[model samples]
Target: MQAISYWLKAYGESHQNPINQKIHKVAVPGIFLSVVGLIWSIPQLSLFGFSLNWVWVAAIPALVFYFWLSISVFILMLAYTLACIGFIWSMEILNWPVLPISMLLFGVLWIFQFVGHKIEGKKPSFFEDVQFLLIGPVWVFFKQ
Candidate 1:
């Protein structure tokens, strides 16, 4: 099997428990959104009257990694990134505080993740390899 398939399968091994999978269904998106929000909260740079935030700049490496993994997954990540940008723009327009909200959501969702891992009787895949952190979200997309 290919490297991406191998990594995905290994990641899936620890996530087989139904409850864990269910927990991830919610937690993955929460984590994704929180990361986006947190990053978006950072001060931005304006070029030619357009504001560009770190979130968009930071996504470059991940997008390249995803592209190397698979075109379909790359497309999914692109869509996810665009959606996150839209969310950040909306939050800005609504004058919602981004940092505090992102932190709260990330912390709560991480607690749920730990609880699910406890039920599964396995540590998170990311504990084995940091790259699993990226894999987790893509794995969720693969599940759908």
Candidate 2:
């Protein structure tokens, strides 16, 4: 964990562009909402008779992509995954609406991000690295 933190901090420093900051501002709430939506969507996933492990599955691409940029991002991704799991378990809510809910959260987060970037007077990190899109969620989640 310390190693991951060190790496993430280093990555944050190196990639501390205005764009990333703006993305973070919006991504935080977006991820929170997305988590809620995921909770809402999980019941349907369970109907398949095998529950899913989101960390190894859904979060892989995001984690791999973050590790490429910084260990901090990987750590953040880890935290985000754990948080999502906790949220779902605590709420005991699940259904098929999670897909659209996640999308809606993403869209809202994106809009907030754009607004943040506009305020920062910079472009989004995605302009430099598309993977930053994935990182934005973790960055936002950890900030809280």
Candidate 3:
């Protein structure tokens, strides 16, 4: 099996419960969007008179890391990153409070995640390995 497959399988172990999977369907994307929105909410910088937020800069390292994992995963992450950027732009256009909204959603979704794990009677995979955190979103993406 490939590396990502292994990580996905291990992550899948505790997530076998149908209710847990359903919870993850919502929570994982919520968590991802929250983090992205928070990062994108950082103050913009003028570089050579070009305005850019830290989110664009920060995505480079993250994309690099994902690329090292697998090309397909890298492509998926790139698509997700672009979607997040679009979301941030839309929220800004609407004058929505990005940081507060992201944080509130993050907290609420995490609570649901814990509840789902409790229903499953198993610990989250991230407790065993931090990399599982990255694996989770991709796993959900492929499942869809």
Residue 99 shift from truth in candidate 3, angstroms:
1.4
Best by lDDT: 1
Tens-place lDDT digits, model 2, residues 1-144: 224354335335434557657567657656655755564455434435787644345556656766775676667666766677566545445434456757777678768766766766667666765554554565455543
lDDT of 3 by residue, 19-58 (tens): 9999999899889889889888788899899999889888
Expressed as tens digits, the lDDT of each residue in 1-144 for candidate 1 is: 247898889999999899999999999988988999998888998999998888978899988888988898889989988897798779889999888999999999999999999999999999988888888889998885
Candidate 3, pairs of clashing residues: none
Choose 1 or 3, whichever is better by TM-score: 1
Q: lDDT of all the models against the reference?
A: 0.89, 0.58, 0.88
* Runs with alpha carbons beyond 4 Å of true place in candidate 2: 1-23, 32-55, 65-73, 89-97, 137-144
Best by TM-score: 1
Residue 96 in model 1: lDDT: 93
Off by over 4 Å in 1: 46-51
Sorted by lDDT, highest first, which candidate order results?
Answer: 1, 3, 2
Better of 1 and 2 by lDDT: 1
